[model samples]
Target: MYGHDNKQFFGNNKLLLPEQPVHDDFLDTMEKVFHWSCIFGVFGSKRYISILWSALILASLVVIEYLAIWKVIRAVTGVARDTSGHRSITARLAGTIFYSISIMSLFVASKLWYYWRSNISLLWAKVERSVGVKVPADSTLKRRLYLVFGLMTFCSMFEHTVSMIASVGLDCPSSLLMKRYVLVSHGFLFMGQDYSEWFAMPLILISTLASLLWNFQDQLIVLISIGLTSRYYRLNGFVAKLCELEKHQTEFNKKSEALKVYTWRKIREAYVKQAMLVRRMDGALGGIVMLSCSCNFYFICLQMFLGITQGLSTDVMTGIYYVVSLAWLCTRVISVVLSASGVNTHSKTALKYLYTYETHCYNVEVGRLQDQLTKDYIALSGMGFFYLNKTILLQMAGAIITYELILIQFDGQGQIDTETTPSIHLNVTNI
Candidate 1:
């Protein structure tokens, strides 16, 4: 099927290193982590240590949550009320869902890496080794990814550290048990048990720190995947430039019919090869994009709800920090969608350029390739459910706005009800 021509077009497949090896190397490392085997491998190497870490984190959060609800809130309000129905449940639910999706995304990303690793050698072998075509350096994309990674890391650390400190300083009744600050508190877990702050705080700190690192790594995997799309965009641009040149050459040299025919064939081959590579990679990422988009949207919506309902006046600095962290997270999802959309747009542009000129000699082949391009444009879907692109952000925006409006109406009605209720007076409450 044009085996020799494939070799001639792609040149030395063994030497298909990109101009930006560092970025490529970084992506390679991330791919290794994204593999599904790494999950079991962590248990194999660390075994009980990893289990202990998870247990400690869970325990700390539970204790903290219990104290915050039962001890602190009860003492302040002078009522033995159960805070189980607090709005924080929304956040907890979102976190749990996102964490599960994050784990699933790892598997998806791993499969993507596996697919790419299997086909990358063949893809490189088919790449047209043209001296005239310049491989663009994609250092800018790499830099932006790292910058986002850094922001995510910084925000996570800041949020956890401040929360930990605030938890410790929270005043509670002398009779209250579990006298330590924690990331969260659970009521049922502490119903019959008493634990020392000594045993809890250290575990909480270690678990919280581990969770932060884990989340950061997960996000890095996503960014790496997006970076590949960015690379695809650049490659598509290169092909488009080549097509433009071919169009001009055909316009000027009418006698060079054979040359024009061969050039168009090579261009078609290039497009086909690029499409195969991008399609396989994007397909592998299908589950990841679907899960991530759904989880991130819900997570962001929960954050906005909490931020709006939980008054900033309670702790001005803390509120601002929390809001900022939410903003950074929202940015990550937006960046990924935009990058995916960019890849699709570039591919369509290349297809348009391919059909921009027609040669009398290779008219049949050109038309065939053009038809294929129209049908085979690279698109990433959310696990066969929906297409993931810029429109995802718009959908999320609409949902968030609708939910906020509903929350506002409820809050106004609640305030009116409170104004009409009678107040109970406590006698000899203070010395």
Candidate 2:
């Protein structure tokens, strides 16, 4: 059938417009409208609207991803048979692409939202400093970093929430039963062999809690620094005199120098405190990373063993889980390495400033450099670095968990016969 202006029509009278329209004006108008609408929509949206939308979209994506993964778990554990219909290769490819894109978008949006909020907070801190308020060392930058970390934590909770929801909504009683069986069996595998599985849950929980704490530690430090600095400003004695000396270095070089020594000494004290904070953070982060790795490994082993012993036919869902889990593991490893590197970098910067101030002495340029370096150190120490590290870690964690689940389903189905083993008579004779 055909419609007006040679537009093809379906049997039900639905018009089938040309993919590439013949009329230039129509295409132009459509493009114009699309661009204008997007512009208006973005602009008309309130402040933080992007962050809100991004969070919601990302949360939805996490939910869907988890659901998809759960389907794989079902197939792997033999809790449910694979009912994947006759999906075209193209359709499968498209679905995979969409899922990947959605996951990537979730990550990107989270990072962007964190950056936006952090920048805003940091800007405000800078403004406060400009108004003659003593901004604590790295207060502005730390705030920014914390904001990002806070967002990452929020997103993680959102993902966990989605998983819990899906567990309730999509999972069947049979699947839950199967999961419980696997858990119990795994517990036996550990305990029955004189290995205590008692430490598993506690270790996992502690690691998770520590990870959260490590992520937000910088924020707490910044807040404390801000408060202390504010108090020092109000005291109207040593700190005020120091600030005055800092401002009038040219007129009062000798007096400023004397004040500078005191300031340097105070800064050294602060640096020592900062170093201790860093040490605690490092230990906490390291513990979390190790615990996460061990937990993931255990999960993978347990799932694989159960699937194999049960003689289940792991399906597409299992494959997805395996892929996701492995990916997550890889991410964790990368994050740990990056975090270590960042800490080293921060330490080096701090040391460099300390050396410059103590040895070369504080000059005009040195003072400025010291201030800038301090800010950078503070920023680096904040959640910004931790957030980046954790983002990678979480993604990897998710991927590893997913992949292992898939592996259990798919790899567990095929069994090798041990009864058909070759005779060892020749080897014994040789011995």
Q: Highest TM-score among the candidates is held by which one?
A: 1
Error of 2 at 161 (Å): 8.2
lDDT for each candidate structure = 0.49, 0.34
What TM-scores do the predictions have?
A: 0.65, 0.32
Q: Compared to the true structure, candidate 2 yields what TM-score? A: 0.32
- Candidate 1 regions exceeding 4 Å error are 1-151, 159-180, 183-193, 197-225, 247-256, 355-364, 410-431
How displaced is residue 333 in candidate 2, in Å? 4.8
lDDT, candidate 2, 44-73, per-residue tens:
123486445434444544553454455445
Worst 10 residues of 1 by lDDT: 422-431
Report the error of model 2 at residue 251, Å: 5.3
